[model samples]
Target: MSLRRGAAHGAAWNFATAVGERSIGFAVLAILVRHITLADVGLIAIASALSEIGRMITTGGSGEQVVASPGDRTVEAGAFWAQFILAAAIAGLLFVAAPVLARAYGAPALSWVTRVLSVNIILGTFLVVPSARLVQNFGFRALSLMSLGSTILGGTVALALVFSGRGLDALIAQRIVGITFYAAAASITARWYPPAFPSLAAIGRALRFNIPMMGAAFVDYVAATGYVVLIGIRMPVAAVGEFRIAQRLAEVLRELTVFPASKVFLPVFVAVRDDPDRRFAVARSLVDVLAIGSLAAAAVAGAVAKPVVVLMFGVRWASSAPVFAALSLIVPAAAVYAFVNPMLTALRRPVLVSVFAAINAASTALAAWFAAPEGLLILAWTLAARGLLTAILLLPALSIGIGRPAWPLLRLFTAPFIALIAARVAAAALVPVLVQQSGLGIVAMFSQLAVGGIIAASVFLGTLALLAPRRIGTLLGQLTSAFRRVPVVAEPVG
Candidate 1:
């Protein structure tokens, strides 16, 4: 198959998988919130955040090394052993530091929660080789389906446990079950077994990649989770939970709308690295689709957040509406950074990526420190606004990666962004007028939704069409062609 076709297939499966996984996650979270206290959620959020930091550290180290390395030696063997060892070390550290973490958070229960979830670190490494090989081979369909299946099983177990009064255990159970199932299924699908003999040379090469990658990963982790850490410092546990939920919802939307291309783009970029025209075409495609899709998601989220919150999370979470809306509105800006990071990776530019990530991390930390003192809602909006403010800074980085000007990429997002702003303003003003009950009941929720959602959808579409009809046509044609000539690959996992 041609490289572009493979990328398209990869992107489609990635979108499908992201949609399915985040949907299940949202549903489970909504249900869990009903059964648990805000404090409970907050406690788990801290523990989960720490676990995520560990996962991110390990993720940057070995599995991705296997994906990035084009090998003469058995890089997979080295990567497998590298990740397994790293996972073990992180797990042990988490276990040992659980008490200190609990003390820092002033929650004794956090110790056990961290310890329980630490097992996931060890369990996660088991799939390193299988998952990497699938991604390296453009087997997104299989990988996507596999992840979706694991999510379904995990969500089912979580629901059952939540109903059975598992509380914090229920949340922890979901990750463990999902990782276990995904690892086992991925290994089976890929039919990959670790070698009995180790390769010292392969290990050295993998480490060469991993060392820089790990630095980038650490910065990436700080940028991603610094808010959680900094906010937790000044806020109560309940406030932290509320903030985490709003951020989580926006992040899920981001994965669906902004980042489906990220998973597909790294290898795609590498494949076309030597061909400037093809690589630029891929980059342009990313800018167009990611910006438009993200803007659309943002518009809807901003307009319908109230009614969606009412329906899924009840009036208890009404505060999250504005926060979610604020975070949602910044998707287009966030897309620029997301799109550039992978391109840099493909160009073997980890140091540059790491430097940008450092900038992102420092900015996030400062933003959180300033905002957390005011209120959670203010902090959410601050985070959202900074996304747009700092996004422009990435254009130079992209220009460097493509060895071309970044002005044209901005044009692709401009029309959609303008349309989004107008539609959102219209939707925001209309919702309050149409919904008299103030989103307290199902009838009122639907009323707000009907006015806001319809206005947002219609205005955004009509305005985008009016402004960029030809570009829309071209983008649609490209997307449609992607679904054609897709080859079936058995024994693949998304």
Candidate 2:
């Protein structure tokens, strides 16, 4: 019952924020596309991406430490302050050095972008403890409201800026404003405050756990962002923008798909962490759910790749179509990781997981660097490889105490993949027939795509239900319940 309540609220908040932000974000992108060059947008992407790397490196494993150590308020506050100070210090130093870092990357325009994004670290610092407390208390509903209020504030400001000709400055300002609001809102919602001084002992313990987790987060960011950096340098901003759109669209689909399952599963993991039998049972159920959810999402993403891209971003972004299709494959792999990786953290093997993340990041970055074309295809291949590597590494670690996951569990993914392939083929076939000509008006193109995608999604969903009723049934039940009270949305993965 606690799980249901928490999840219900979390999903509601996630959904509202996701829908509002994404809709307004796409609008922001559309506005920017009309006003700025692709290169400018790409530079913004680079700055944001690099800041995430820095943030992860600075904060380290504090979050996982908090997660692992239950009900330790003093320790939690200590962890928050330590991470906050470190993140703020880094942000300050980085602000001064942003110009040099941009020069090092051969994109001097990124200096301002970097400086602007640095403030996010400070904003994030203030909110970390509060946000953590909310999640800790399972007050997802309140969390959702806080997040939406911030998002609406930010999105509204962004829209205004775009219309006022702020260009990419709108992007930077929107983030700062949004984070400020979010932090303030979450702080109010959680109602937990720290004293003037942080506990040294608590900081020490948090660092012990968080450093490795931070390392892992750093690697994850690097891996995901490496391609964007490479493209920014080797290709034009337009190309980078196209690629970013693909990545973003893919992630949106991923988040929407997994929100329901994760909410249902997080408390389950926390509860069964100490019970091997129950842990394994929960793990199996989660895997089944993830497989079904992921594949189903992938299918729809694949089917609508062309139409969705054109529908949302306008005709200029048609290049993103294939990239979206390529990225669609990584959704299932990410879903798998979401379940396995968290389980590892809960098992107190965060270091091992961090190591895995580092290896994955290194290999992915290397692959991106080596794959010179910088096309979505290469990016897709790199992500798929990373996903495969993560799964392989996790199986052995998870199997250690639980033996092996049931073999038949693998079969659950078969139907969804098949549906995805079929949808792609159908979309590919329909694109030419419906579109017939290139460079038509954006509306006409998107209309054709919408028609094609709806038809394809219907086929995909219907086929999955017919072939895998159990999975379909589980998904429908969650969706039904999720909408009944509040929308429970997932975090975007791909």
Candidate 3:
């Protein structure tokens, strides 16, 4: 079949895989929270963030290079060797930083936790090329199955560890297991393996393309999770845990709604890169769907953020609700990256993307530095507002990539913005009618969340349908056809 058909199939499988795996992942979090203390959560959050920064830096450009080159054995070997080398360097850095982190947080456990995770990152290096190869060939079906298996197996191991009174290990072990499964499974599925030796010249070529992406990815991750690091430093331990939960929930909504399309955007963009008119047209369509879907998801999540947080993580995490809402408000704005970055990469504009991410990262870090000491809610809103600012700042780059003025892109979010506001307003308006007390029972909170999410979403769709029927119709059309079954990747580009 055609690349268009393959992309739709990839989107379908990716969406399904995201839903299934994240559903289990969510359950794992909900379970872990009950048994795990806030202090332990804070410790792990800091460690995870640090190690993950390394992963983001090393893998960002290398994998994209693999996908861009397609079936180039030399490039694949170079990417793997490059990622592995970076992982090693980062692991060494983590080892050195471990003590500093422990002292900074007054959590001695972090030193060992950070050390263990350093090793995990090293093991994780093996997966990058295989994973990217799957994407190169549009083999998302195999990747999807591997993802589900990874999540399930990892979650199982985690729960067992937790029940056995090892909550910290549970959390870390889950990631390790998941990575191991996916790395091995993807390699098998793609029938690709690393060569016996490295290619210095190919590595140089890959680095030229990937170095800017490394900075972009690193800064972009810092923009999102930098608050946790700031909180761990400036605020109380419990606040770190609360913010982590809030971030996790916001991420869940993002993974479900925006990322499915994002997973396929690179390949799609690459396929159409040579045709400006088709490229811009495709970019426009995806951006609209991304904006609207992201807005709707964020609206509903924001509307029910309170009850959902309470019910899911227990009343202890109720404080995270406001934080989630603050973060949720920026979903449409932040979702811009999911589309824009991939588009920029396909357009050979990684440096521009780096600038975009750097500005956001700097602004967010500045905002957090001031806001963290004030309070969690203050920090959250500060970061949230910065997310919108990032979107505003990114429009010029987006316009340049598509060879259009910024107004057309700016106008795309108008209806979705309206719908998002309407949904939140409608949900808030129903609270007094539905909730009588803060100390309500579990069933009551469940009812509130269910009713609130449903009505909020309904309002969003109704507003969109009323305001822009044709646009809404097109978005719906994509969703409906996005599920037609087909082979994940029939052939490779090379």
Candidate 4:
């Protein structure tokens, strides 16, 4: 299959997977929130935050290597065993340290929660190579189906457990079941098995490539979840829960937009790594689409956060609304920022990626610390500010990687930023009127969100169309044409 066609198929499947999984996951969360208390939610958040380090270590850079070098059975075998060992080690470490982490957070429940969730690291080890093989072969359809099925089944189980009042244990069970299903499905779909042993040389090479990537991933993990840890330490557990929910909602927007794009585009970029002009063009198009889509989603999500939170989690979670709103501003910045790792990795610049990750980690830690005392809202705002700064920090590197000036790359953000501003204005003017007209029930909240979202979206899109008619037209035409083409499945790149 042609690269364009392959990309289209991959993107389509990734989008489907993201939409399906997130939808089911969100439903499960909404239900769980009704059953779980603020402290229960907060405890889970702390557990997740602590487990993220292990998760990062287990699956970090290994999959990228597999995807990038699919022909190397030796490397794949090496990565498989290496990751399995690492995952087991990390799980053990987490088990041993759970008490310490629990003590640090002053939440005794966190010890067991972290220990239970730690098992997922071992499951994640089984996932890395199979998933990479699927992506390498452009087997997105199978991957998407597996993801959707696993999410639905696990979500069902989670809902049942939550209804039975399992609380944090329910969340832990949901994660384990979902990942176990995905790993099993991926292994079956890939039709590959690990060898008895991997060559030392192959393991060395894999480790060399993966270790820095792991470093970057580890620091990036810290950057992403450090605030939650700090909040758990310095603030109340309920505050951590609120921040976590807000982050989750904002991340759902991202998962639906930028996350899938990142997954799709990374392999695509790696495939075309040798073709500079093509790579740059593809990167530019991706940036344009993500910028517009994520900003639009963020704007609408920010505007409707209050009503949505109230409706989804009831009035008790209403406190998370402003945090969600604050984090929404980071969406566009994150969209732009997503390209950095993929593009640099494609160029075989792990060192540069690591540097960027370090910078981001330091900045995020500092920002979170500075804002921790102020409250969740301020911490969230700081997160948004740090996102923008991270994006700015990445521009010079992106310009260097893509062979484009920083100015044009910066210009790509202008339309979306302007459109977001307009959307916010429209929402501000429309929301109060809708609230007054509809009163304050669930139905009213839904009506207000629906109407307000539509108006805001229309304004944003209309403004963008006016500002960049030609670009929008070209993008639409490309998308339409891509959709019409017959998908061609290809063998994994060797």
Candidate 5:
């Protein structure tokens, strides 16, 4: 298939996967909240955070290296063995350190929870090779089906356990079951067995390529999960739960808007790796499109965060609304960063990407530490600020990668940013009027949110259409062409 057609297919499947997975996850979480206490969720959050670090260490950019490399069975096998060994080691270390973590947090239950969740590190090792092969071949349809099935099975098991009063164990069980299913599905779909003799040279090459990438991944882990760790350490366990839920809601918007496209772009960039001009053009175009969509979605989500949180998680989580709203600003920054990072990586600039990620991680860690004492809202704001700082730090690399001045990129985003601001302002005004007119029952609150969202969307699109008419027209044209079933041509091999 042509690069365009391949990308479209991959994006469609990824979107389906993300939507189904997130929907099932939300349902499970909503149900679990009803059965579990905030402290329970917080405990799981701490365990999950630590496990994420181990996961980063285990995967350590090997999957991306595998995906970008040529179809070499030796390299694939080497990557598999490397990942498996590292994952096992990490799992063992996590198991041994679980009690120390529990002691640090003064939560005895965390020790066992951490130990149980550590199993995912090993499970993830089984998934890396096959999953990377699928992505390399653009086999997103199979991947999507696997993801959806795993999500459904996991959600079902989680709900059953919750009802059976398994408490936090239910969450751990859900993840373990989900990863197991995914590993099984990936193995079947790829249908490739590991070679008995993995090449040491291939392993060396992969490790060399991955060392810088792993540094970036580790930094990313700190940026993404460090806040939860800090909160768990310095604040009440309930506060960590609230912050985690808020972060999850904000991330949902990101998953829906930017993640699917980024997933598609990675392989596309790999295909066009040899052509700098083409790579730059593709990166710039994706940045423009993702920025417009992601920021607008973020604005709408932030505007209606209160009603959405209450509606999804019930009135008990009302306090989480502001946290969600504050964190929503991270969406646009995240979208741009996601687009830029893969483009850079595909162009063999992992070290540059690592530098940017390091700066982001360090800045965000400091911000989170300072903000933790103030409360969740301030911490949420800190997260937003971290996103902004990341974007700023990334500007130079983005300009170089795209072969354009940073100003043009900044200019491209101005319309969307302004539109988002105007939308929020409009929503801020409209929501109060609606609330005053109708009492704040569930129905009224939803109505107010609906009206506010409608107003915000209208303002955002109207402003975009007025300010960037050609860009809007181009997007529409692409959509029209996509629906018309254009002929597929094979992508140029790098």
Candidate 6:
């Protein structure tokens, strides 16, 4: 129908997809954890992380080229095939290398697991074009539903496999099956097919756009993976297991809350590519929503970090509560960087974005070197530095391009910090009271949740309402309008 309608549908689908996918992953993980040791889990983490890094590197800049290139259905489909072939070839190599990589990491047991999980990379190549199309065209509704269906199917299969006592193999199988089904569903839903004559010329053109984007991607990979690498090198495998779980939980919250909005904003940038004023307005609104929502989640995470970890993963994971709390601070800070990155891309500022990313990468490495001795605390310092550096680097671009924020963007920091402090106080007060109870205490569970929820809600909402009423009103109106829009696609995918 309209751009807004497409965005609304896309947002709805993204949220549904996230919930479904993450639920399946969590379920599969919990079941697998029963049979596998922490060291096994650590290997799984390394494998998955490596797989992601592989995909990012091989595909490189195709994601940006999808937007930058102007092409008809034939050219687009051909380009998609070429990229898919490239990605599949790369994934195949990694699949074979999985064993070698595992041996190097001193976790040879992970070899098969890595190989099985590598199938996802191949499947991802096929889906990327359609996924980008759905997002580029604001077809979130279809995207989300396909994702949900894939997740449910994947989850059911994994649960059945777990029940059959296949252990980590089942988890690996779950990923392959889920990604395959997800891509098939996405292709059907988006009504896209690869053209027969895949173009070398198109590939070359796309590479011109994507190579720089690849550099940016590499920086991100290094920044993110550095933690996993550092943790594996410096800490016990069991400690890595704890940090991984904590990172997973924090990431789940982030993907659901932040990523959906970022996806919607990308198309917004595309639509208003030439109008700096409108682009800035859209960017500001997106940032405000992200900042406020992220703060609220971080507050709850900080407040209930102890109980949440204990309830979800068991007392063995109690240490993750603080680790998670440290990582939670990075979410809102990362949101600002996330918001601006897409805006820069839409405005043909990928090089500038790369520069900021490089700075983040260097800072992350330095932070890791210093804090590596302390486990999660090192990660915390790294994230804190990232948030600061991201904001500083973006300021010149923001001031010169996007209008100055209604409030200093840094002012958004107050709510999360305040919420974190308040939540920690609440946690310190309530944790001792509830955690002392006997086996399987629902009283403790609900009380911790209730107290945490109230404190987090009060602090996050009160701070935002008082500090930025205009931004709040704009967000409420946007959400309301988004709900009212129909979910039909107005433009052709081809």
- The RMSD of every model to the true structure, in order and in angstroms, is 4.2, 4.3, 3.9, 3.7, 3.1, 4.9
Which pairs clash inside model 5? 2-489
Model 2, position 38, has a per-residue lDDT of 70
Query: In candidate 5, what are the lDDT values of residues 1-494, reduced to their tens digit?
Result: 77777887788788888988898889889889988899998989889888878888778677888888769787787777777777898899999999998999989999999999998988887787888899988899998899889888988989988898897878988889998999999988999666675678877777777778878887887876655887788898888888888988987888888888888877998888788777766666667778788888988988888888887888888899999999999887778678666777888888887888788778878888888889888888888977876787778877766666766665677788889988989898878876665543698668868887898899899988888777776655554555456743222211
**C-alpha TM-score for every candidate:** 0.94, 0.88, 0.95, 0.95, 0.95, 0.87
lDDT of 6: 0.67
Over the stretch 384-448, how does candidate 6's per-residue lDDT look in tens digits?
65666666665665554464553455555555556556655665676556555544355776667
Q: Model 4: how far is 74 from its true place, Å?
A: 0.2
Q: Per-residue lDDT tens digits of candidate 3, residues 270-376?
A: 99988988777777767777878788898899999989898888988988999999888767767776766788889889898788778878887888888899988
**lDDT (C-alpha, whole model) for all candidates:** 0.79, 0.68, 0.83, 0.81, 0.81, 0.67
Q: Compared with the true structure, what per-residue lDDT tens digits does model 1 show for residues 418-451?
A: 9999999999787777667752789888888888
lDDT agreement of model 1 with the native:
0.79
Candidate topping lDDT: 3
The residue pairs in collision within model 6 are 1-490, 9-141, 10-140, 13-144, 61-210
Error of 1 at 222 (Å): 3.4
Residues 182-210, candidate 2: write the lDDT tens digits: 88888777776654666677778777777
Provide the lDDT at 45 for model 2. 81
lDDT of 6 at 451: 73
Which 10 consecutive positions of candidate 2 have the poorest summed lDDT? 485-494
lDDT of 4 at 464: 87
- How many residue pairs clash in each candidate at the backbone level? 5, 12, 0, 0, 1, 5
**Compared with the true structure, what per-residue lDDT tens digits does model 4 show for residues 1-494?**
77777777778788878987887788889989888888888898878777777888667789888888868888899888888888888899999999998888889988889999888888888888988998888888988899898898888888888778777778888888998999999998899776678778777887888888888888877776645776688788877888889988887888887877677777888887888887777777777778788888988888788888888888888889889988888887678768878888888888888888888788888888778789989889988988888888878778867877755666788887898889988898987876665545787788778887888898889988888766676666666666666643221111
The residue pairs that clash in candidate 3, if any, are: none
Model with the higher lDDT, candidate 5 or 6? 5
Alpha carbon deviation, residue 309, candidate 2 (Å): 2.1
The lDDT of model 5 is: 0.81
Locate the minimum summed-lDDT window of 10 residues in model 3.
Answer: 485-494
